[model samples]
Target chain A: MPAYRPPVIPASEITPRSVYLRRREFMGLMAGAGLALGVGDARAEAPATVPLKTVPGSYKVGEPLTSRDDVTTYNNYYEFGTDKADPSRHSGDFKPRPWTITVDGLVGKPQTFDVDKLIADLPVEERIYRMRCVEAWSMVIPWDGIPLKALLDKVEPQGSAKFVAFETVVRPKEMPGQSGYLQPMPWPYVEGLRLDEAMHPLTILAVGLYGETLPNQNGAPIRLVVPWKYGFKGIKSIVRISLVEKQPPNSWNSLQANEYGFYANVNPGVDHPRWSQATERRIGASGFFGSGRRPTLMFNGYADEVASLYAGMDIRANY
Target chain B: MAMARSPFVDRLTGWGIYVIGFVPAAASFWLGATGGLGADPVRAFEQTLGLWALRFLILTLAITPLRQLAGVNLLRFRRALGLLAFWYAAMHFTVYLTLDRGLIWSTIIPDIARRPFITLGFAALVLLVPLALTSNRLSIRHLGKNWRLLHRLVYVAVSLAGVHYLLATKVLDLTQVVHIGLVVLLLGYRLVRSLIPRPERRAA
Candidate 1:
């Protein structure tokens, strides 16, 4: 075998790294537009169970894990539909395999990785997290995935990148909720996190739930799981992660800013106008008449680990 | 073309309406007993009761329109329908208090006082009580013209309930707007009807 040699090329012919990155961003933009248009051949496919191998994760909640039945059936994946049961009922046709996530924007290495390949490379673990919803419902979930910082580290975010923006797959053809006469929200559900929040140890990119690859309704493929923030902050079925200079718009906040703030930390003191956040009805915790409810802890009981993230900021005002 | 019917047929039809009206409440009980109310049974049960109450209120309001526009005389069933609405609304509040709020008066009182939707809903329920109590013939005979005047409060009760429903939802989507739209249309019809001078009424 002869030693490989560099191809003879003029210095002017070489494309600058910035230009190449811009081209990738353009391609990413086109892919997003194509998804929004409901391009043909993006037909729905049934999601099958794919078990995952995992080790014990670091942030394990002592509370009883919510039943897998409840966790799987009850979901807020608006892509599938708005109702809790709609996701489970209508998501059978959604396809989660052959997925790819593009991590670009202000990063040194702008690369798109196949989701399966990324999952295989990551150190997957089982983390039991307490998820609190702004609607005042709580659940304890055992998620299987790697820390989000692990993925951000690979992309090598630039110093200018102050926030991380996430975008969900917008296939109206397969996802029933994305279509129809009355749309619940703007298409391609978007969420964002301050750079520090994205790099927090407690945050994870969950690949599986209860040892099996995520069911379509439960944000199959991969989803962000920020243990401290309200569950809406955990965007599902993410297709894009762009690190940018300014804070990105959040779906709920964009719809109603005063009600749903960008920093949706689970604070019991700050009451939602519609309902009190002081308490939450723990789903599937007890009998019919006895709705298992408990006092909501600040930061969803993860205060010890995450309170410093907002140390001096007025939580009520931020809320 | 109103069809004249015998007393037996009228009584049978009235009982039939009540039987049919009670079916939803019974079905809800069965679902709660069998764990068919889904992940959050309390919320499911509470919403189901509340929705049925609103539906029954709509039906009560529709009786007048049906009689005038469609030549359908459902007048005999209006009281039964109004009573059903009251019962369902009461049950909705009961579930919220006992199951949803765990009968905690401390939290429940504050919830009613602070949350505008809850306050509106509670006021609606309170307004419905007097209407529900005076729905019988004895009260109609005793109260005379005052009975009709008092029961006009249905408009206020339903309006409050409609706004309460709209406010309770997190997002004011098209469906929610349409839900309250029906009430607005029904109430608007009554206003329009009252404004138009009926030749027959003026001659009488």
Candidate 2:
């Protein structure tokens, strides 16, 4: 391994910045045996050049190059057209303003907050996270958003809250494919997560990427991005957030029942019938070009940190 | 021989069709050029071109029947349309190989080898190459009757194309089923026509 440069916060760079997990909290998280290694250990200081891996310690992060002008310019945003690049041209019709999200269902506080008001109450933190799509492509984006937990706390989930349901705006005129699908999907694309999953520190409510306010095609205004799960799990153009007692019907699951389960925790071993999820292609790598794909990790390698939460549950079946 | 109302009009109409056929390709390119290809622009571009390519391929396939029934023909335009179909199809495959597979030949080789749908598409495109090359009348005259027999591969090529689309989507719905049915109908026409009895010629 390259000289053990410590791993960075890997968290949102929020103003009045987050106190990097208090020593007590870190010690408590590690428990007795794990804490013996010392508290607040952010891995070794990672070298500037390590072969990047989905999980740390697997490879060196050799270069900082993770994006390219060509790839970024040509993207596949399905909201605009079936083609990766159509959205950028056709999405001018999408109106991100006058947008509001209704926080209700099983929350202690139920209220709808408009765009400006929403951000005013919560802060936008710049977070650098790797986003992996189920189609096997990935991009390491510096996304700006609020911690999902922080947003969830604002909603004040009731004791009955077991799940979090999210919905994107659906307008056929703006989103032509809203009804033009060969396959059927519940419009206003829906996605959800268990209460704990929703609150995972890694989960984020993204509003922007690459520092600027989100462009319309990239789920302008607001979207949920769970870096650890397949990209589909990150529903965009969200207009609704509901804390519910039952699992919400997610778009992909409603479309492919068995193929896409309710809990789409990233699993390398379980393959989608049509394709393998074992590997992901990291776009914009150097001479490597598209060769940087590596095996996906369970819980996206956040398992050791979050796996115990699902102890004894067969992940294969869940997957 | 049919007389033209105005040779310039005919020429303009011909140019018009060429421009019309190019519209879809141009629009897709414009999207790409404008940086609107979206999060998966490579896929978006590929799908646009691929879908249009398939539509054009089907249009190319439908030409004979339309001509036979409607007495309408565009033999002069056929070559250009066919070439455009090939160009789009090539772009489709290129997107799959480069953007989709990340240009890893190893991944592409196995996909072609193992996936029958991909195999069919690859084979169909492969068969088109020589037919496309020898489409000229000089080559047709050189090959004699054999030229017609070779060009008949197009019927099978299109069926393969439709099947590739159907299987790749993995959908067995009526949209694709209708496509398959049309292919069957086309082949059926040829089969019945071949079986028809012809008048006997007097001994020379």
Candidate 3:
């Protein structure tokens, strides 16, 4: 594994002098008003208006970002429903506020964090990423959040912790897909990452997108964002984060072991058993009649930074 | 007794079937043009066409079963329904080629050869060709008893289309299961009908 090099991002380089000054003033005002707990309610009600004060993250892809409408509407949140349009339509009743994330399991300092407080305390940044789905569709999104490493650092992983497992909150009353007689998959949807992968600079725990708090359909409170892997690896509406000794089970991998593997890195070389992964339809890239197929990249174009992590291992066999 | 039967009614029903059969394809095209198909319009558009093809194939297969079991004498329109299924299947294939795969022969060829669902769909479409060509009066008159034997391929084609639909879906949800169930029931009816001895025709 590559030695974790601390990114040398001077504070001034991340935010403008005026915005930086205002953020400190804003934080002071926020603390005085006891606003940390109530912030999620206000943000949830009107996300577009109350813009997040964010620094520009190290990674920013130059591609045109997908429209917020499409980003929110076209989702694969099976908790809401199996159809792409089902999430946006059915997630109206989902309550993302009053959320607590439990971080434990092989950690030195196990703790539960109120999601809003965590967002308020940490410095959020905007990182534009190319999200490639396992279904052969791609989108460029500007995600706003802190690096997952920063969150992992808070609890201090134990020596035995080899993997980081995550779980989504199960609220069947709101999430119709979970309440239905025939569920898409076993729920409290679970996902996991290697400890190193979780700590990678590129992995983030996103709270918002497009400079606004995430909409209900888009994993409102918080979600994982690993730009290098297929979109499914970045589990949404995360509730519990556990540092484990053994390789934890992934929801899709558990459902179809032959089709979905633990390491679902975006590789055109490894095709899904049902369909080819050689190319993907770039959402909003082309009109109805035009070809939207774009050749997928190795590790979703993060190969330079991550290729060495799996240098000795056979990717095809692992895939 | 009753008034003389109007010959125009049969002709009108046949024309109506053609018009009604084309609506789904037209509506899908309009949706794609108007941005109603949502993100990944090509996929939505392609799947819609494929779905309509499957629906029409099921409708075509139901005609004989309905007549045999329920005494619904709709056999005259069976040719039009079968032809409609073929046209929709043809359109579905065209869209997949021109839009979905962007007419990439290398990828399309491999998908047809290797992918089980695609191969089954391709075989289904291919089987419909001779049946569609022989649906006319000329071919029927010329071939006599052989025409009926050849037309039995419709059952095979419809069955393949049903299986293709089932395998293409990532998950076997209730909606898909219902569709596949209908196909199985119709095919099973055909099998049961063949085994039982036919009753003698009543003198008209």
The C-alpha TM-scores of every prediction are 0.89, 0.65, 0.88
- Model 3 docking category: incorrect
How many residue-pair clashes does candidate 1 contain?
0
State which candidate has the highest DockQ.
Answer: 1
Q: DockQ of candidates 1 onward, in order?
A: 0.20, 0.06, 0.19
lDDT digits (tens) for residues A84-193 of candidate 3: 87687667778888889999999999999998899889999999999999988999999998899999999999999999999999886667666534466777889999
The order of the candidates by DockQ, greatest first, is: 1, 3, 2
What C-alpha lDDT do the candidate models reach, one value each? 0.83, 0.65, 0.81
Worst 10 residues of 1 chain A by lDDT: A33-42
Candidate 3 chain A has its poorest 10 consecutive residues by lDDT at: A34-43
Clash list (residue pairs), candidate 3: none
The sequence of per-residue lDDT tens digits that candidate 1 reaches over residues B1-204 is: 256789898899888878877776677666776887678878877877787788789889999999899978778889999999999999999989988898778778999998888999999999999999999999999999999999999999999999888776665444445557778999999999999998665531
Interface RMSD of each: 17.4, 20.1, 16.3
lDDT by residue for model 2 (A1-319), tens: 0111222322342212113212333343223321132223342221121111121112122335355343334444555544343455456666787788888898878878786566666767766666666666677776667778987787789999999999888776566444332212446788999999899877888776655566776777788988767778888888889999998899777766767778777777776655567777666542222345566777766676578767888888887
Native contacts conserved, per model: 0.47, 0.08, 0.39
Highest TM-score model number = 1
